[model samples]
Target: MADYADITYAVAERIATVTLNRPEARNGYTIRMADELGDAMDRADRDEEVRVVVLTGAGRDFSVGADLSQGGFDFDPESGPDAAWQEPAGRCSKRIFTMHKPVIAALRGAAVGGGITITLSCDYRLAAEDARFGFVFTRRGIYPEGASAWFLPRLVGMGTALDWMISGRLVDAAEALSAGLVHRLYPADTVLEEAYALAREIIATTAPVSVAVTRQLLYRMASAPSPFPVHELDSRLIGGLGKSSDAVEGVVSFLQKRPPEFTMRVDRDLPDYLPWLHDSI
Candidate 1:
């Protein structure tokens, strides 16, 4: 595992847990933290032993947005217009978006601005009962980052996303759940454990390669121009089922009334012809 200044990474029982470690600052979002988060996600995705990843914070709160105590963000005007620059939150969220492994976000307390935006790409979001979320970019007189403008509307409806982003209001756990922003809610103390339990369930029941492919397919093909492309892809995938070891095991295990031991690994076994893996579809 790599050493991280603002985060911690650990893998146990085929699950990698990446945590925000800046408790003293209420897990404030920083450039270093974003870089570490992107690195951690890439590390986990490449680790064949890691089946799922759980993202959480060390302190009571997940994150309170960007750290401003040190006079706000550090910007360099000398870099000029030609310099390559990417926002901090996008560094993490974009990495998560491309990952082949599933990521579950365990959020508690306040998740505001960059805090919530960074988690928009997670496959599942499990929050604490007392959690509060806000997309307060407008309130802060800044625009949204982390590609939240794309992910938010897909998770919730366009109406909810517009309302949340425009008003810049604080949304409680109940309202967030109702809006489909979060998958489930639990007590603050148990939310992390619940996330682990879900990860364990996935590890025990699903094939790593199948899960990886399906995750990518849903995210990439769901919003395609039409269902024709999806049908073509689905046909190709289904046509190869007879040769898939994991598919055979899945059926055999059910017939034998036993648990399946999937042998296909994500790193080595994902189909080479996956559309997203190539530049052209």
Candidate 2:
């Protein structure tokens, strides 16, 4: 709902579409754009009316990475080591990482460096057949931002992440799909619609609270040291299901052969006992 200069945020039919709006520059990533994207994603996460988020760009390209037209980043050395600092791309990626609502990235054309890293935290990445991805940090003589080293290996594999990041080669849509970097590829014009269709499917059949919990659970527990902790958490969640209205409705609707109309809202219904809700990951 807030006015954003770098990105456009709109909500309809329980889907929040957050768009990178600077098509003239290929939606070049900038500090202002990062801040605006973080704000927009946070807004969508908190709004109870929003069930899913679809992230895309305005024109042919998603983004060409950090804007260098002004001679790269403006770093203030005078701020010293004590200053609170976070990389521009990390600002957006970290927010998406913690969001309860499912975030789907619909990418087209170039999604390189910061552009591609920013979407690494999204739950699903749907790309256009023309989409191209590259880490390119090593080529630029810069380190990776957006905690990409942590998220990328999980999405793809360690070998793939190492190869891509180290080589800084552009990956095409088919290779990206084979490497599990993206969920599916579509024509450039239809990628966004495909993302929306997926969003609508989730909205129609899934309980918001369940989706929220499950989303976080998978992200938090996937790399867990042992299954015991996960088992314990699963037990707690299952034990509480008897009192869940959504659980009851899920069963009843299925029995009646009807579409479920789940009433549990993510903002209000997420369990307080969820460890990741309070713990920083």
Candidate 3:
């Protein structure tokens, strides 16, 4: 694994864990951190050995948003060396958005500002009982970034999205879970362990190719014009997989009451339509 200054990366048992490492700053985010995160996520996505990714912070907090020591100047787009501007925070979110494997967020302590937006793009977010969050850009005299304005409404309903962004109030883990922002909540000390357990369920029982293809279809088709596109993709995938070795093994294992050994690899076994290959489309 490549070295990263702001985050730690490790893959074990088909699960990749990306840790935000700036505990002293409460994991305050920075542009460098964003680049490092994007790099780490990309690494996990391309590694065929990896089936799931878990993102969590190192210590007391997930991230308190950007490193604001420079105050307003920190957000000045013109201040950065890159002249052709794009939203720096959004790039990391996009990386998570595009990943083939499921990305799960394990949140403890303060998950506010960029912290919340970043996790919004993840497939599932699990919060510690002590977790607290806010869409605090309005309170900070800015608006939501990291393409959160787009993702927030989709994850939580538009009414809830507007309420949070408009009020910019800090919320507890219970509320976040109630609002559907996170899947479940656990004690802070056990949250990371819980995340791994969830990942194991996926790794142990699910077919890698099927998981990858299903993730793609769900994310892509959610914004689709109609269900027809999803149906088309589903028909293609179901038909293709019906004759695959993994499919046969899956059935026989179920009947025999044994664990399945899915041999199909996501890297080479996926049909062209799954990833929307240029030639196939």
Candidate 4:
């Protein structure tokens, strides 16, 4: 089973749990997994039944970064077609940042290199006390890929970022917590349960629209300056849903102290490149 597809996504009770399913190779990411992941995010974001997403690994290690057997991802002096080939795999990790639904990374084991970038994109990062995070790009003679170069410094200060990237060291869960890389830590056996418990708590109180809007706002804030025209986008996003039955139910449910029968379908109009739009302009 560990040698099966590298990714798996399933939705149940309004939550989607996406597993990095490859365990034998320590769940290392392959180009094929990247392609599958891109499609999975699109499906989750569009599915009305899914309110939250959890990312985890199936085995002892979360991921050991890029899979080397399938042609190792190494830097090449020539930057042309080779760059395009490399871009797709990197984009797989970036999709986590762009996806609108709330994501939680439930870490239980080794999260290294590109794996660390995937963990960072998640809204809430929960790790097992024994889990270790390694920044191995420098050790492998490659610069960080998959948005880590930009995301790491923001999560941890520039100095800490440099320490991790330059020194190529592995930080355990406690250090990751102190460094601001992880939000909470649990014993290894209970980490997944705690992650689900946390997700359930959010589901209980958060309005779907508010959660989606807040996620969108955070993505924009992370990528650009404040007063970031997000309000305009927010209004547009809400306006499209204003007439939905879920909107009416949501407003009435709040007044009546009843659970909202949220039926608003995810708008297909949401741009795929929302996070990069500001930079593009």
Model 1 score (lDDT): 0.92
What is the lDDT of every predicted structure here? 0.92, 0.92, 0.86, 0.77
Write down the TM-score of every candidate.
Answer: 0.96, 0.96, 0.92, 0.82
Model 2 residue 106 CA deviation (Å) reads 0.5
Specify the poorest-scoring 10-residue window by lDDT in model 2: 73-82
Off by over 4 Å in 4: 1-4, 73-83, 222-258, 268-281
lDDT of 3 by residue, 122-216 (tens): 98899999899999888889878989989988888999999999999999999889989999999999999999999999999999888877776
Write out the backbone clash pairs for model 4: none
| Weakest lDDT window of 10 consecutive positions for candidate 3 | 272-281
Q: Who is ahead in lDDT, 2 or 4?
A: 2
Model 2 quality (TM-score): 0.96
User: Residue by residue across 1-281, what tens digits does model 1's lDDT show?
Assistant: 36899999999999999999999999999878888998899899999999999999998999999986644455755654344667889888888888889999999999999999999999999999999999999999999999999999999999999999999999999999999999999999999999999999999999988888889898889899999999999899999998899999999999999989999987777778887887531
Looking at candidate 4, the ten consecutive residues that score lowest on lDDT are 272-281
Query: Tell me, what's the RMSD of every candidate?
Result: 1.8, 1.5, 2.6, 4.1
Prediction 3 global C-alpha lDDT: 0.86
